[model samples]
Target: MTRKRINVGLIGLGTVGGGVARLLLEQQRRLSDYLGAELTLARAADRDPALAQGLDLPAGVLVADGAAVVADPQVDIVVELIGGLEPARAFVLAAIAGGKHVATANKALLAHHGREIFLAARQKGVGVAFEASVGGGIPLIRSLREGLAANDISHCLGILNGTCNFILSKMTAEGAAYADVLAQAQQEGYAEADPTFDVAGTDTAHKLAIIAALVTGRQPELNDISTEGITKIAPLDIQLAGEFGFKVKLLAVLRKVGQAVELRVHPTLVPLGHPMASVDGPFNALFVEGDWVGEVLLYGRGAGRRPTASAVVGDVLDLARDVLCGCPGRVPPLGSAAEPEGPLALAPLDQTVCKYYFRFAAQDKPGVLAAISAVLAEHRISIEAVIQKGREEAGPVPIVMLTHEANEAAVQRALARINALPFIAEDTMFIRVAG
Candidate 1:
């Protein structure tokens, strides 16, 4: 009943990495019982050598460079927690070359260079587990890559970024301006110092790129995913959305239409009754639709030290079980090798139909409503409802319109025409309505 210990080497000793190490030590007995093998941290590599000073590390373990740790014959598995492109990519490839299984949480690395890395891992006959990459601890990756492998995935919509979600949730709940809420998020450590990646939709796009790859069986071209950030979302818009029975949230949506797959991330208005609408604060939710399963939603902590570490260690345990069973590479990196046939088509915004919410200021005068309605008619964009308010501050009156499913191009053209009219004040505020 005795089994050999699986040696694990860790790269990066920051928040997540530290959490992983602590969890591995704290849960070693249970993990070993489940895995039928002892898992040990044989070595670790961190940028700051002094990071190991206060920690209780095993004796004779090397605190060497990442390359050395990966190259070490003693380390059976390598955990890469150091995020970013260059060194992380190089180190991971080196680990694969050295015949070590990899467990990572780097979404950006996997999104940008996943094909190459997975191909290399396949050739090397090693497992590369990235359960922590997509929805942090949600296990959505496994659900998509394995649990639903039998179904044909038609769509994947997610509230993927926690920082952006936190900011938007605060803005909506507290009626605070974007800047004020973002500052609070930063102060609370929910956001970063330079929150551009989180707030500007880049982070969600990265996660979506990975999820798209898993669902479509093809690497999504990052540039092809049209991205719109949450920066332009105003408190007024949030208030209006609420009055109209909706909530604002940043959503990463991917859908298949015929041969095309439309991938986008933006601030969207979800009906109050929708599943994603209730996923407020620093939480993530994914809604996946398949031909057979219809619709399934996954919700959990999207990020954090322990939550992310839980995912990473879960992958490590899965890999250890495979190693124990002598079933290396039993599952393909993407759950399958067949490339998706045909060109990856994206539905043009104009052609892609959806309900829309439009709000803008207009001059308080007769025929103003008629002029706006005429422009909408000219573009074939139908208005489902209209709310007009008298001037509150002796200027332009506020006009709000909700449109039925319409082409985005027509909406833009109509809005442009309305903006040019002598009565319309400025560009109209438009938000996509989701159910």
Candidate 2:
């Protein structure tokens, strides 16, 4: 019995690309047995060919030109681990045009130019599988595309950024400041030096945009997904949240609201009992609610070399099998045909209604609480609980409150009015309480 052979081309020799190469070489026999076809790492493209990746490749397999790898007649599939949107996008577009299947771990590229790429692949009649783009090795994208294909996904809540989760987990456990925890994360290599993309919720939003498109059948504009960072999450807020039986986590959320979709990323206060609250430290968790499946939780290492590489290789095998079986493009790029209509109408942030936790710095004087309550009353916002810490004679005192479900627009208006009060010492801090 002879097995069909499929050649693989990889771009980028960075951490993820190195892992993919190592896996392809080390597991060639195992993968061949599983796919019933020989999967060969025929060629790879990296800017620095002499970078010493510590992997043994056959002679002449390494190339300095990405376009050459894509244009290689022997390369059947292109696995792109070179992140970011620029040349990676160009390489993917070129591969699709040349009739090569693509497997990428770049969430940002897909988030920004998914429709264009998917449309090109569909028209070219080649498949684009991106299992590593979202939850690393959790297989969430494939689950949504195939496993839960029959159900209607209504809500998706995820702690998608490992850097932010690590910071939050350490902050909660040690009662440390955000800056201190972030510094520790950077020192531990859990966060980058700048760390803006991971901590600012941009990374989570990128993955969320992809997930929302898969679940809701409508791709949302990047700007429409309201994004907020964790820089403002203070240790005091984390302490107060514990008192209210909640934990602070940077969350990416998407839910269908009638004809609109509510997409946003921010620091959220999740109840202690919820699984998302328990997802701690450099780990990722996604909770999706389906009409028929109830609630599903997929958790794993969201990023890193080996885990992410495993996902990339899984996609390679998938495409390899499709090519071997002469069934390429049987599975659509993002689970279905790209919607003919435009982007989904994003539910305005101001119109959102949810429970909230608020922290206010106020003068340690009489009538301060009354003044704040009066403004909330004007907006019809009612308090569910209050925690007023000991007052300081000269320094402003902290007053915390948990509000019942209220309109986001009303809350913003109420906050503005309260901030204007003479007794209020500083701008108020608030986090939406996840339901």
Candidate topping lDDT: 2
lDDT of 2 at 392: 49
Worst 10 residues of 2 by lDDT: 336-345
Distance from true location, Cα of 111 in model 1, Å: 1.1
Candidate 1, superposed: residue stretches over 4 Å from native: 62-64, 339-345
lDDT of 2 by residue, 42-152 (tens): 998899876535789888889998888999999999988889998999999999999999999999999999989988998898999999999888899999999998898
Q: Deviation in angstroms for 186 in model 2?
A: 0.8
Best by TM-score: 2
Summing lDDT over every window of 10 consecutive residues in candidate 1, give the lowest-scoring window: 339-348
Local error of candidate 1 at 174, Å?
A: 1.4
Model 1 has an lDDT value of: 0.86
What TM-score does structure 2 among the candidates reach?
0.98
Q: Residue 326, candidate 1: how far off, in angstroms? A: 1.8
